[model samples]
Target: MIGFMKKDIAMIKNNLKVLGVLVAFYLIMGLFGEIDMSFILPFMSIAIMISTFSYDELNNWNSYAATFPNGRKNSVKARYLTTVLIILIMTVITIILSLFISYTLNKSIDLEMTFLNMLAMIFGTALVQSFMYPIIFKFGVEKGRIMILVVIFGTVIVGGLFSSVVDLSKILNFLGVFENHWPLVLIVSSIAILYISYLISLRFQLKKEF
Candidate 1:
């Protein structure tokens, strides 16, 4: 698992230039845009992490990895671990950038709210990846890429409709009820979702023929 994680880290490092460009673009937008878009940072970070599947597929890495003992399960575990690490790193960066932006704009910083929002964004992104990885494992990357886009756009449309149809005040009130325990709730829910995703990916990998 450690070796697999190192491979993922190296893959991410190789793509640093592309990720740097994305970060710069989003930072500029957050600095000048009316609304805070720092959440997009973690969102894009997950997208980048998922793209490793495409890279591995293109290089036939999965077939090669199959020769190693327990490679498929380790690969899935590594991807999940990589996603968690990226989320943590990007969340911290988002917080710092949000604080800097607020300070520059002479706005009040709501650290608790900002942190909660970041966690929500990370959770949302991870949920998407959880659904995505199983498909990629089952179908290979080319078809999986199309499915990923479908999943992403479907999520956006569903989220937009849900938000529009839901009562905002009720949602706020529900959140208010759990205000003191929100952090614990978020952490537990995120972990549970990621573990379920890992299990799904592992099952897919086990059944896949490399």
Candidate 2:
């Protein structure tokens, strides 16, 4: 399993030059007023996972991996685990940066609330990936890529529209009912979503063929 993960990481690192360019550009724009840094984190997380899955799908790396001792299940597990690990690390780093920026700028950002919102965004993105990655694994990247884009873009558009019409800011007031318990609720809900997504991905991977 470690070997499988190493190979995937190696593939990601080998493309570091390209990845670095993207990350740097994102950081610059985020640091500037080009876009809210908070908005970039989940998108970047989703991008990394998609890139990993897309790379495997396009290269048929799993087919080669299956010839090893651990079999296809390990290959799938390695990919899922690696993707989750990367997302968590990236999310943490993004949170720290965003907080630092908010503090320096003296913006009225609530660190805890922002953190929860970021987690919610990541969870939402993962939910989409959980459903798509298996299908991508089963089919080839060429076809799967189209569907993934549609779902992601469609979701974003709908979400933007919904937010425009309905003020989600009311969540803070609604959540005020819990008062001191809000943190616990946020943490528990985030954990539940993470676990559910992982289970879905695992089940999907188990059913997938090389």
Candidate 3:
């Protein structure tokens, strides 16, 4: 298991060079003006995860993965674990870089909102990944890419409709159950979604021959 995990970790890290280029680009933006560094991290993290999926598909990694002792389901789990690890490492790096830049430039920074923003980012990214993973597992990345775009567009359309008809702030008030503990709420919700996605991925992988 350790050997498999190390291989997966190495593969994940190798796949991150594109993300390194993106991070450098964002750092250049930071130098020019104020950019929402928090927002950039989640976007870059998602891009990295998607690129990993792309690489796995292109190389028929799962086919090779099935030859392992634990079979494809464990391999799927390892991939998901690697995705979470990469996102977390990138998030930490982004936060540290953002703080350094903010302080060096004497920019006004709202540290209080950092945890709240991270909560939202983690939940949002997990939601996107939950929707993407099942499609990728079943359809392969080429078709899954199209499904991913559809999901994004559909989400935007749904969000627009909600915005038009619902006062989001008011709705937040209506959902007063989590008023004071929104971070915990988001954390719990993200865990539940992740659990569901994991189950779905397992099912899809089980159905797959290789």
Choose the strongest candidate by lDDT: 1
* TM-score of predicted structure 3: 0.84
> lDDT of each model, Cα atoms only?
0.83, 0.68, 0.78
**RMSD for each model, in Å, please?**
3.5, 4.9, 2.7
Quick one: best TM-score, which candidate? 3
TM-score for candidate 1, please give it.
Answer: 0.83
lDDT for each residue of candidate 1 in 10-108, tens digit (9 for 90 to 100): 888987887788777766877788766777778877668867887898899988887888888898898899989988888888888888778887889
For model 1, the stretches where C-alpha displacement exceeds 4 angstroms are 148-179
- Kindly give the stretch of ten consecutive residues in candidate 2 with the minimal lDDT sum: 37-46
* Cα displacement (Å) at residue 44, model 1: 1.0
TM-scores, each model vs. reference? 0.83, 0.69, 0.84
Candidate 2 lDDT over 44-79, as tens digits, reads: 656666677777767877778778886577777786
Ranking 1 against 3 by lDDT, winner: 1
How well does model 1 score by local distance difference test? Answer: 0.83
Error of 3 at 152 (Å): 4.3
